[model samples]
Target: MDLHIVDLIESLNNFDENPSARLSNSIIISDYPGLISYLIQNLSGINIKILRQLLEYIPEQILEEILINETLPSKLIEHIKTQPPDYDSIKILSDIYDESIYEQLVDSEVLSKLVYSIQGAGPKMCENLVKVLVFISKHKMQEILSIPNSRNFGEILIYRLNRAQGIEKKLMLKTVTDIIFSFPDYFYINDLKVVCDIVVDSLSNQEEEILTENYEALTALMDVKDFFDLKYRFSEIYEVLQVPEGNSYILKIQDRIYSMISN
Candidate 1:
C-alpha cells in the first residue's frame, strides 16, 4: 500500500457507503495489474446505491475518464437500470459521451425501455432522449420514435440551444436537428421551420465566432423552405460579413439556398 495511494482514499473525506468503501479499497489498484479483479471479488455489494455512492465521492471528470478507459461491467450497468436514475446522476452521465458506455446502456433491456419511457420523466426525459440519441445507431431510430413520449424533447433541446453559443452551441443544435429528423414523429414535422428560424435568428445576433462555424448549418435548414425564409437574410448576412472575395463559401451556400426555393 503506497502511502500516497492511501492519502488519495483518505482525502475523499466524507465517504460513507459500501461502494465508496469498495472504490477506496482499490486505491492501489490503478498501479497494480489484476488487482481490479481481486477488488471486484471483494466488492460483493455493487448496487445502484453503492454505484451512486461511488459517483458521489469521485469527481465527475474522473468518472468520465474511467467510463471511457474501461468497459462498464454488465452487473454494474444492470443495477443502474433497477432504480430510476436521479436527475443529477443522469446529468453527470449525460455530460460524458463515451461510445462504449452508450453501447452498454443501450444493450440493457431495462434501460432500452426506460430511455424512451418519457411519460414519467417529463421535461427531464426529453433531455435524456436528446443525450442518448446522439449515440444511437441507425437501426435503433424506429425504436426511439416508438417511445410515445410527446415532443417535450424539442423543448429540452430548445432550452439547451438557448444557453449554448459559438461552436459549442452550433454543434449542440446540429445534434438536436439530427435527433429531430430521426424521430420526426415526435414533433409535428411541419414545426421544423419554426425551429430553423429560431436558430437562424440566434445566429443573426451572435458574434462572428458562431457565424463562421455555423453558417452552413443555418443555411441547410432552408432545405425545408415551405416555412423558413432565407434569401433576404442570407443576402443581408453576406453583405455584413463582406463575403471574403472568391473564397466566399458562405455566399456560395446562400446562393444554393436561393436556387432551392424562390420566395
Candidate 2:
C-alpha cells in the first residue's frame, strides 16, 4: 500500500469514534481517490462510521466529480445513500446537467433514493434535492417524472414550497414551474394540484420575478386542455394586477392572462 493509504488505514483503524479522531489524519481533496479505493476494496467491511465522517470532509467538487464519472462505484453510492444527502454536493452535481449523469443516477436508483429520503433531510438539503430534480427534469423531462417515486418527490417539493420563504420560495416555484411548463402531460395527470395551487398563490406575490415565472408557467399550462381549471382563478389573477405599484412585468402578466382567457 502507498504510505499515505497505509497512514489513512491506520488512522481509521485507530479511530475511537471521537471528533478528535476525525480531526486526526483527516482525508483531504487529494486523498478522496485513496479513500474511495479503500472503500471499494473493503466493501464488506467498509466502516459506515468512518465513511460518513470522511464524506463530511470531502470537498463538494470532488464528490460531484465522482458522481459525474461513469465509473462511480456502487459501494460509494450505497454509502452516500446511507448517509444524508449533502446539500453542497448535490448542488455541485446539479450544475453538471448531463443526460448521462441523469441516466446513471436513475439506473443506480440513486435519484429515487435521494427523492424518497427527503422526508428527514434538512430544509436546505431538501431544497437542493429539488433543485437537482429540476435540473434533471430540464434534460429528461419524461424520464424523471416517470420515476415510481416521482409523485412523492413532487409532493415533497410542494410541501417545501408551502413552508418556504424569500429566495427559497422563489427557487421552489421556479422548479415547479419548470416541470409544469416542460411536461404538460405529467403535470396535468399527476396529483399535482397542491403544486399548481401554490404556484397560483405565488402569482399574486409582491415579487415580480416570482409572479413572472408563475404567469409564464400558467401561459404554458393554458395550452394544455386539462389546465383550463386555471380559468377559474383569473379573478384572483387580475386582482393582483390591481395593485397600484405594479410594474412592466406585472403588465406583461396581465396581458398574458388576458390573451389566454380571450383565446
Which portions of model 1 show Cα errors greater than 4 Å?
1-65, 68-76, 108-114, 117-129, 137-142, 166-168, 179-186, 189-194, 207-213, 225-249, 260-262
Q: What is the lDDT of candidate 2?
A: 0.60
C-alpha RMSD of each candidate structure in angstroms: 6.4, 6.2
TM-score of every model?
0.59, 0.57
What's the distance in Å from true for residue 69, model 1? 6.1
lDDT of 1 by residue, 151-180 (tens): 544555556566665555766666555655
The best candidate in terms of lDDT: 2
Regions more than 4 Å wrong, model 2: 3-131, 147-149, 164-172, 182-193, 200-205, 208-211, 221-227, 230-233, 241-253, 261-263
Summarize candidate 2's per-residue lDDT along 35-56 as a digit string, tens digits.
Answer: 6566445643334345444445
